[model samples]
Every structure is written in structure tokens, then in C-alpha cells.
Target: MKEILPRQIESLMNILGTIPGIGAKTAERISFHIITSKDNMVQKLIDVLYDIKENIKICSECGMISDTDPCHICLSPERNREILCVVEKPTDVITIEKTGEYNGLYHVLWGVISPLEGIGPSDINISKLIERIRNLGIKEVFFALDPDSEGETTMAFIASKLRDIEGLNITTIARGIPLGGNIEYSDMYTLSRAIRFRTRLNDNL
Candidate 1:
């Protein structure tokens, strides 16, 4: 059958389809919307995309994506200096932030250590985390990573490094999150329970 849309419109649809969770049908609708919409709409989208590419950067201190150097969260003086919460990604930080149960600062690991994937302890942002803990006089750190094997391995590795820091405490959410589950998907209540009933990790780690 001959294509209903022009080459340009079909190209747009194909591009949109590549986005995760936006399948062919949805991409078709979106492509149709964009092409039929005013030229200003397309122009605005192009401008924003370019702006995102030009302006967004990773926060040097926390590894969170931001438009500024340190990011607003790190610059804020009200955040708790004594406690830090380590998460696997920037999205997980947002998930935990939604619970309104924690006042501590955050660190985004960017990725976990997966031997099969060739990701190691040095690959992610661990050195910066150690530097932060040592410089900030942090008392405790909470690990809010996922419940999968990779998460466990990452936690175990991080715990080992923190042990050398005398007088510092390491902890993780107790039991609310399910095995193989991700913190990004867990509800706020469950996350709150996990944070509230967190357990301490020691030499047994």
C-alpha cells in the first residue's frame, strides 16, 4: 500500500517511535499532531530541544542533571548536612523527595556496578561521594537503591568504602520495597516506611 503521509511526516513518526514507551500508533498520532499544528509549535519544540542540549549539564557535586553548576539542591543551605541519601539515578532522587520524609542531601550514582556490563566501582560517582562525606562531616548515609541483585552488589561495594570513614554510619531502607523492585516505582507510603524503619549496615555489611 502507498504511504498516506508525506516523507517528512513519516520520518517524524519514525523518530518519535524510537522514544521508550511511545509505540508506533502513538508516534503516528503525535507526528500527525505536529505536522498539522502551526509552524510556531514546531519552531518552539526545536528551540527547546536546542536549548536543552546547550544548557543542561551534570551537577559536579551530586551528579544530578541540572542547568547550573552545583544544582539548586546542593546550593540550598536548608538541606541537612549531617545526613546523605545515596541513590542510583536522578529519577530515584525525585521519587524519594516526593515522600517529604527526608531532609538529607543526595548523590546520584548514575549507574550500578555490573560486571557483565563492564561497569565498575570507579565508573560511577563513588570518589566524589567519599570526598563529600569526608569534607561535609556527614553522620549517616541512607542507600535507597533498587532491590535487585545489581543494587545489592552496588550497596555492598559502597558500604565497604564507607567503613573506612571512622564515626560515620551506613544504613538502608528496611523492608517495604519488594525483591527485584525499583525505588522509582514504589509508592510514597512504602518509601516512607522503608526510610522510617531503615536498618544499619556494619562490618558484616
Candidate 2:
């Protein structure tokens, strides 16, 4: 077998490594797999990648990825139009949907506001969210952000903005030590539950 050139493999590995969670070793494995795959399979993969680049676009109304402007969720009549769930990414939308607990629409922010990362309201789609709330007459907004410091800060900012909006309700998920957590490693379920079930911020403290 002829030896593969270091520069050739290295160039491909570098680009693949740029993807989140894909390191050099994994990239090399994937590159080898792709190069050794059948011609049809490799051609199909290449075609799909190019098609996604050419066709995928953000939904104008909800910021979800879609081939069309509004996306299926925004256009679906079965969805509850009055309720809106705000999530940090499109993947979060899938996670929540899997729970089968929510029947509302979604607004994917694409990311959270993080000062350390130089991200702000403008960096995401908060302005478009505000417009959607007002124009679509959304009655309730659920903040389904991750359970982290930045998520908390983002929720606070959004709540403050919607506080005075009449006929609109803002809510967040309940918190507890996770379902399968050991008390030893757990931060504090009592504290977490206290925060989750608290009637107000002061009550929790």
C-alpha cells in the first residue's frame, strides 16, 4: 500500500478538528473511513453536505433551521400559538420535544448572552423575539435555558423585559438534584428544590 502524505491528511484533520468535540484522533479515524468508503456512499455524503450548505436557512419567524422561510413549527396550525418556549439552540428544541410535556412554539436564540464570550442581546436574536412576542400576541414565554450561571442571567434579563407586559406570563423550569444523582456528589437538592418551588426570589433565600 502506498503511504498517505502527511500534509494531505493533516489538512483534512485540521478542518474536521474544528468541529466541536472532534479532536485530531477522531478526525483521523473519520478521514480514513471516508477515504475507504464505497464511491456511492462518499458521493452521497458529499452531496448532502453541499445540499445543507445550499438549502438550509434560519426560519424568519422563529430562528429555527428550515428549508423554508417560516419553518414547519411556525406555520403549523396544531401548535399553540399563544405559548412560546425560548431555548439557547435548535438541539434544545429537540430535547424538550422528546419530553412530550410542551405543546407550544419555539424561538431558538442560537446562543446565550455571555459577556466573557463578547455575546450580547444583539449577538443573538432577542430583538426579533421581542417583536414576535408583541406581533404574534404570545401570552406566555417559557425560559428553558440550561441550568447554569449564564442561563440564569439570561432568564433574568428576559423576565425583566417582559415583567410589565400585560396578559403575558413568564416562567422557567423546576429544578432539583438531577433524577439519578447521588446525594454525596449532589450540590444540594433541598436548595435546588427551594429555588424551584420558591414563591419569589426572597422566599428562596
Highest TM-score: give the candidate number: 1
Q: How well does candidate 2 score on lDDT at residue 175? A: 57
RMSD of 1: 2.1
- The deviation in Å at residue 39 for candidate 2 is 5.3
Q: Please report, as a residue range, the 10-residue window in candidate 1 with the lowest summed lDDT.
A: 1-10
Report lDDT per candidate: 0.88, 0.73
Residue pairs with colliding backbones in model 1 are: none
Off by over 4 Å in 1: 1-7
lDDT of 2 by residue, 1-205 (tens): 2155577767777788899989878988887887778776678888999999999999989999889889988999999999898888887676666555677899998888898898887888898898898889998787766667677777777766666678677766555534433222334444345234523221121
How many steric overlaps does candidate 1 have? 0
